[model samples]
Target: MSAELEGYEQDYAVLTAEITGRIGKVPRLVGDEKKLMILNVEKQLDEARELLEQMDLEVREIPVQSRSMYSNRMRSYKQEMSKLDTDFKRSRIAYSDEVRNELLGDDGNSSESQRAHLLDNTERLERSSRRLQAGYQVAVETEQIGQGILENLSQDREKIQRARERLRETDTNLGKSSRVLTGMLRRIIQNRVLVVILGIFIVFTIIMAIYFSIRRH
Candidate 1:
């Protein structure tokens, strides 16, 4: 399970890093918020897995099928889009120094250019966002399936543990019974020896009394 989970996490990190790679800035999708979300999903998956193991459930990695996997991928793409959106907006807002002074820091001549650029970038960002959202939804659905299986596995593990404990107890009791039987055998042997000695003493005393009585007569 650990191996499976680690594989999932490794792929997730790689996907996020690749998508969010940028110039003069850290990876976006790998940022704290997204990272936390990914981590949380991972934790959930692990818990479910542990429960499954306890139940002796057979688990296997489905390979990029979990929500965290898709989310990690989408997260990277979204981060790249975010950077593009930020750049587009900032560029459209920036104006020539003279233009800035002439119209209260607004460029009327460049207004059309700004609007066109911003609009184009906005559409691209929106499209990317939609794609990411869709991918994220799929990832979430996969995680739900994982959770269900883990839940079922947990029950099986508990049953197995209880059975194992019972078997251990039975074994212990049998060991004690065997010891008791051995002690009884030893005591029986000791008593037989004592009875034989007592019998010999009684016989010797009776023979001496008869011999002494005959001689006196």
Candidate 2:
């Protein structure tokens, strides 16, 4: 890894950690303090984005073999950043809802009509909260499904690589067997030819012996 890439990574990590800490504090605070913390986190998130872009440029310049590992790390960092942003947004919304509820509470001095109006607003907030909860649940399920699909695809790629290696091994073994069969066939043909030559020599000798005996007689 280049020194520049390492520097960017370190900066990103620190920025994200700070952002996470600030987001955690947001819910515990209220009014101006909470709003200011939210703003600070948002600013840090933007800085994190810049750092990620710098890291991406560095990764592209690196060698191909090492690029993949860094690229994967970059993706992981982006995902973490996204989750942090989501958590921060959720905290901000929860804080807003908390403030709204406090405002809606009927002080004992509230008239009957005022109390009734507050009750109606409270009901609307509750309905909205329920809808938001339902949507968040669906989003979570969809993310899980997408993760599962990616895992399956990764497994399938490994299976294909293993199958290709096995095929290469099989081809190598077949090549050896073919050479062995060829050698055995050649040897069998040579042996047959030797046997035919020996038979012909024996027949010639027998005919020569018969002709010599008849001439002697």
**Model 1, range 1-217, lDDT digits (tens) per residue?**
3465456445545543443332113222333854464454445434433433332211223433444454444345445444544543343345445545565544366566765787787777767767776786577557767776887799799999999999999999999999999999999999999999999999999999999999999
Error of 2 at 104 (Å): 15
- Model 2: how far residue 2 lies from native, Å: 29
Tens-place lDDT digits, model 2, residues 1-217: 8999999988888888888888878877887987788788888888988898788678767654455688669768866866776677666644344555575564534544765676666556656755775675466446545656776899899999999999999999999999999999999999999999999999999999999999999
Per-model C-alpha lDDT, please?
Answer: 0.56, 0.76
**TM-score of candidate 2 against the unseen true structure:** 0.47
TM-score of each: 0.32, 0.47
